[model samples]
Target: MAKKAVCIMSGGMDSTLAAYMLRAQGYEIVAVHFNYDQRTQQKELESFRAITARLGTGQTYEIDLDFFAAIGASALTDRSIDVPTGGIEAGVPVTYVPFRNGIFLSIAAAIAEKEGASVIGIGVVEEDSSGYPDCREAYIEAMQRAVNLGTRDETQLTIAMPLVHLKKEQIVAEALAYDVPLELTWSCYSDEAAACGVCDSCRLRLKGFELAGIPDPIPYRVKNGVS
Candidate 1:
């Protein structure tokens, strides 16, 4: 039997590319997505389904955690705080979602344990990503250790962060090489109709594509000559 991997896909370029990388490595993908009532939850869910179909993976999970809205701390889940569109800031952005990756990984670990998967893949880019504390390599490694210690003795799962150290440009190049459906992915933190090109997520994605010398396949709402 082929090794099974639970890929924590967020319907974004990074996670989709990570899933494809695992598929290329001969692992049966069990794609997992979360709907935490974010601003672009519907759009993200749509992208997730489309990406999963393109991956041809039958095993998929869409878990909804409505607690994010109740918590209401981050800009993504809370409507009061505006998402930063000026530029990438120096420290952690308002859209960090307060230990979002850690929560997602814990849920992924549960899914992995239930599915008997040996690996849990998450696409967390440290270098070119929004400086979320949860996205750090050391934090993820610590979570992995904690997961193993908390799970059953027979269940040994490795958290695979294939894009941990990769730059956005490198990620874009690799995603194109793998023929990932970039058009089907969504990364905007605010707008759901069309990607707000000025937002941090959109800017980062666009910059990566620009640096890679490849045009982004997705449409963007031009803002201040950007897009």
Candidate 2:
């Protein structure tokens, strides 16, 4: 029997690459995406479906957690707060969705156990990311311990963080090497039709492509001030 992996994909470059990497390792993908009422929710959902179809993943989950809108303090979930366009900031960016990865991983653990999957893959980058606290390696490890302690005694799970230490450039390069459909992944925190190139997320993605010497396939509303 082939091994199974429940991959928590956000339809972003890093997460999408993580899923593809798992598939390369010969694990049957059980893709999972979350809809938490973010600004680019629709675009992300569309990308998720397309990416999974291309990957030919097994049973998929499109879980809705609308409570993030009500619990909104982040710019992605609350329109009141503007997503930063200047550059990546010093500490945790306003885009941090309040332990969002923690919540996502918890749900992923449930899916992994129920599906009889031994692995749970999450693409969380610490160094080249937008400085989200929940994306740190230490935090993910702690969450892994907690997830196992709370699950069934016989069910053992491995939380995989394939891109935790990689730079955005590395992620982009790896995705291309795996023939991942980069255009199908959405990274803009706002603006679904065309990426707002100056936003932190967009800038980081653009920077990655720039450093990788690859042109980003997605359309951007503007091309200036993307650093």
Best by lDDT: 1
Tens digits of per-residue lDDT for model 1 on 138-181?
Answer: 99999999999999999999999999999999999999899999
lDDT of 2 by residue, 1-227 (tens): 77999999889888999999999999999999999999999999999999999999988999999999999999999999998878887988889899899999999999999999999999999987677888889999998899999999888899999999899898999998999999899999889989989889888898889999999999998765632
Per-candidate TM equals: 0.97, 0.97
* TM-score of model 2 (CA atoms): 0.97
In candidate 2 the C-alpha lDDT for residue 158 amounts to 90
How large an RMSD does model 1 have?
1.1
How close is each model in CA RMSD to the real structure?
Answer: 1.1, 1.4
Candidate 2, superposed: residue stretches over 4 Å from native: none
Model 1 lDDT at residue 177: 93
Estimate the overall C-alpha local distance difference test score of candidate 2: 0.91
Model 1 scores a C-alpha lDDT of 0.92
In terms of TM-score, how similar is model 1 to the real structure? 0.97
lDDT of 1 at 76: 95
